[model samples]
Target: MKNTVLITGSSTGFGAAAANYFAAKGWNVIASMRDTSKDKQLNKQENIFVTHLDVEDTASIDAAITAGLARFGKIDVVINNAGYGLFGIFESFTKEAIQQQFAVNLFGAMDVAKAILPHFRAQQSGVLINVSSGAGVVGFPNASIYNASKFALEGWSEGLRYELAAIGIKVRIVEPGGATQTDFLQRVWGEGKNASIIPDYIPFLQKSEEMYANLGANSDEDAVEKIVAALYAAATADDDQLRYAPTSDIQPLLNVRRSSSEEEFNSFTNGLFLGK
Candidate 1:
């Protein structure tokens, strides 16, 4: 039987890349996005289904799954890839913005998992892949809320893996971050521009920018293509691994965090953003 993978936020970047990659591999692709019109060519591919899905809306989530199942009898994998970064000073974050960040990054993912697990439970086999970021573990400068959301996701996935494993469902988290040119980063830049910046925080924010430009995220030899490989690895692996830091600088940076003493780590992290 052919495998069907349902991916959220498939209109662009990693999600869009993944949709095409999986389809090319002959897997049935359910490319769900808030605006399906964004990629008119996505549905044109063979063995692909394009559908409207707003991660924040439970009704849309349910409908997308229903439509996907109707088109492809079974969904073998679900990639919770619908999320964005809201970066800037914490004090500048409006209440609405903070809530929206968690709503899409944490709660929306949980809701999607909840909606899909019943099917996986019945089938006794499925993969639930969450596309997390380096922010999941490392707190980037001026990205407190973004860091918080990804950290919550990391913790949630760790806790959920065992329960899902018991039902033959494999939960995997793919961590990738540190690229500045992707549509994701562009969105972050645009969103941050509108945030009401406090004068006192301006210097700190500039330092953060310097940190990112000079000593920012770790880079792998490969590019975004590594993400597709990582997703494929998670979806196809028949092992007990729960976390993957493929194609991003997360793994090496994680090494730095693990090898350093608490004080040393603190000094190192602060140095990037504080220069102290």
Candidate 2:
């Protein structure tokens, strides 16, 4: 029997890429997204089942898992890849906006993992691949909330791995730098209820944007492909290998964080972003 994998946010970006890659590798793919109606291409592929799964909604999460099991008999892996970016100064975010960001990025992924644990336990073998970001490792300007969400995910996955290892379940994190082809930036939500920018922060925001644009232009062009490879590595790697950094550009930053002192790391990162 082929191993089956269910991926959230599979309608686009790295999720969609992973679905296609796994299906091509002969694994049964559950290509899940929030809206199944928008799935016009992935569903047509053999061994790929496109379904609705809104990670923020527990009912939808359960329904999607049930549907996958019914179709594939057993799920071997669950990829938590559904999330969006909330960008701007921390003060610009309302309580509701902050809550919503956490709801989709952090809490939503946790809910999916929690929902699938029983099934994984029953099977005695399963992998949970949480799609994190480089921001999870190193903070970036104008993305404080996004960084926080990913950082939380990293910490959660690290602790959960130890707890789940004895039960034959594995937890891994894959961090991707920046993908050029995705609509990720276009989908990013701005500050607060009205999505308005604070006048005082505009100049700083523009500088940050310009810097990010330059960095992105210099980043690896095939980020999605690299991320898919990282996902595959995480799924199939040794149980002890918990973190996979897929992009070259981010590796140096992560290395700096790992090898430098707190003050040194902060100085380096601040220089990169704030031009200090």
Candidate 3:
């Protein structure tokens, strides 16, 4: 029998790409999103089933899992790809916005992993892949909350891998650099309550935006493809590989982060953000 995989946030971007990739590879795919009605293409595929799954909603998460099992018999892999980015000055964010960022990015991913662990343990074989970000490894301006959430996810996944290894379940994190093709930038939530009107922040925000625009312009054209490839690697890898950095653009930055001292790394990143 073909292996079954359940992926969250399948309505677009990496989640959608991964759904197609896995189904084409002959795996049964449960392509889940917040609104099933929005699924116009994925459901048309024979091996891909579209379902509703709101990561912030436990009931929806449970329902999606149950539905996937009913359709595919068992879930051999669970990809936690549901999340959004929060961008703005750290001080501009409201308590609610910060909480929401953690809710969807960190806690939501954890809940999905928790929900699937029982099934995985019973089967003695499963893969749990969390879609993290380059920000998880190194911080970037205007993404304080996003970085925090992904950093937490990276650490959490690292720890969980050890606990799950004895039971034959594997945990992995796939960190992609900016995926310009996705709606990620468009969907990023700005800080709460008149943040844009704050004059003192305008010039800095403009510089940040310009820097991001430049990065997007220089981004790898095949970024999504690389990310999907990484996900495939994480799902199929036999040996224990904990982290996969798949984007070409960010590899150099990651290297600098690893090779340079903390002060040097800070200087390097500061130059990028400050447009020095």
Write model 1 residue lDDT over 1-276, tens digit each, in one string.
799999999999889999999998989999999998899789889799999999999999999999999999999999999998888777776788899999999999999999999899889999999989888978877688989999999999999999888778899999986545333333434455547746786666555565665543455556578988899889999898988887545565677776988898888777655777
Worst 10 residues of 2 by lDDT: 179-188
For each of the candidates, the C-alpha root-mean-square deviation to the true structure, in angstroms, is 2.4, 2.3, 2.3
Q: Can you give the lDDT of residue 148 in candidate 1? A: 97
**CA-lDDT, candidates in order:** 0.85, 0.86, 0.87
Those runs of model 2 whose alpha carbons end farther than 4 Å from true positions after fitting are: 179-194
lDDT of 2 at 213: 71
Residue 225, model 2: lDDT of 90
lDDT of 3 by residue, 1-276 (tens): 889999999999999999999998999999999988878799999999999999999999999999999999999999999998787677766788889989999999999998989999898899999999999998987788889999999999999899999889999999999825334233333523413445677677666766777777868888899999899989999999999999987888889998999999989988988856
Candidate 1 to truth, TM: 0.93
Model 3: CA > 4 A from native = 179-196
